[model samples]
Target: DQIFSSALTAALMVGLAALLCGAVLYPVVVHLSADNEQKAREVLDSHISMMEALGRAIAKRDSDTGAHNYRVAWIAAGIAEKMGIEGNTMQALIAGSFLHDVGKIGIPDAILLKPGKLDDTEMAIMRTHVDQGKDIVIGAGWLDGAQDVVAGHHEKWNGSGYPARLQGEAIALSARIFAVADVFDALCSKRPYKEPMSFEASMAILEKDTGSHFDPGVMAVFKPMARAIYDQLADCDEEATRKLLQDRVKHHFEQ
Candidate 1:
């Protein structure tokens, strides 16, 4: 009876000690977790700011108003959401859309800003922007997720694209989705080379290229949403578009 009592008492003492230790450490652990989460948020915000700065630099170099980046990012994110793409994939699509033309920074102004169609040689040189963009984003760890759209946006659905000529599902989904958004925006937006085409004309072109220049699946999802998206963004100025895109970035990345 004496031995049993001692063993029972020892077990109770050990249990009490463990409970005390947990009580003492729980608050510290909770504090550390909260601190870590805040630091992570700060790091993410800094990275996003850096991405915006690089996008602005590319726009300045290309003589663009930078509205294209904001518009495309907004449009792509919308389409992605409709297609049920969420989480990190959606975030990558947004980032890639903003930086898709970043490689134009490396192109000569003669080619990038030419008022007329590029000749064969100039076109060849211009296409190198895709590779240049890939190299630029590949070096940054935070920007790594963007490499897919950067490297593969120019690729077509039928294997007629540049650089790699990737076909069908072989191309990154983000790139495919961005291609649809990019072409739609370019057609509807005014440029030095030509006046903006009407929404009808733009959709017509996108429809015609369904399986040739664009992914059929992505186009199908975007077709219904195109008119609303264009109408909403068409009249908005750069500031408005920027604010809209910032809200989207926050939704996908910070929230």
Candidate 2:
């Protein structure tokens, strides 16, 4: 009986030792996991920063001040939220807005930088940017989400637009949302070919193109917020606008 009791006590001591060790190691393992996660995020953030920088570079190449892309991103995100677009899909819209013109990087300077209107041949070459842009985004593992927008941003609602001529809902919703924001910013911002239109004029143009150029449903949601979005972003510079939109991407996409 004495020996059995001693053995039992020893077994209990061994079990307690194991339990104590596990208890001590649990928090350490958790901390290590957290550190690993943080490191992974840092790596991802670095990739995103590089990708965004590339977007800005592409914008500059296209003779833009680079603020246009950021503003478009801001507008697209807001419109998307209003339209109840959320999750990874919404991230695609925002990212695609930034990188939409990335394919312009491939276009020759003569055509892409021409201050005047593109002639028929030049227009054909320019339109190839959408497909090029899709290839660029789709090839990048991290940016694969942006494929829809990059490929279809120029597509018209009535199937009159380029590349695939995708119509209505057949076009990815992200691209549809982006089209509205893209034209809105384009109309409001000064370009080499045209002067910036006034808010009222811009709204008029947007309203006129509702079904032909943009998704009617998306436009319906955007019409009410257009002026407000412009007011909030009109005064911001490229860097300021980029930072604001970057924060949105980090919050919505990176999280």
The candidate scoring highest on TM-score is 1
List, residue by residue over 105-214, the lDDT tens digit for candidate 1: 89998888888889999999999999999999986887888999999989999999989999999999999999999999999999877799999999999999999999
lDDT of 1: 0.92
Q: lDDT at 82 for candidate 1? A: 95
lDDT of each: 0.92, 0.87
Candidate 2 global TM-score: 0.89
Clashes of each: 0, 0
Which whole-number lDDT from 0 to 100 does residue 28 have in model 1? Answer: 100
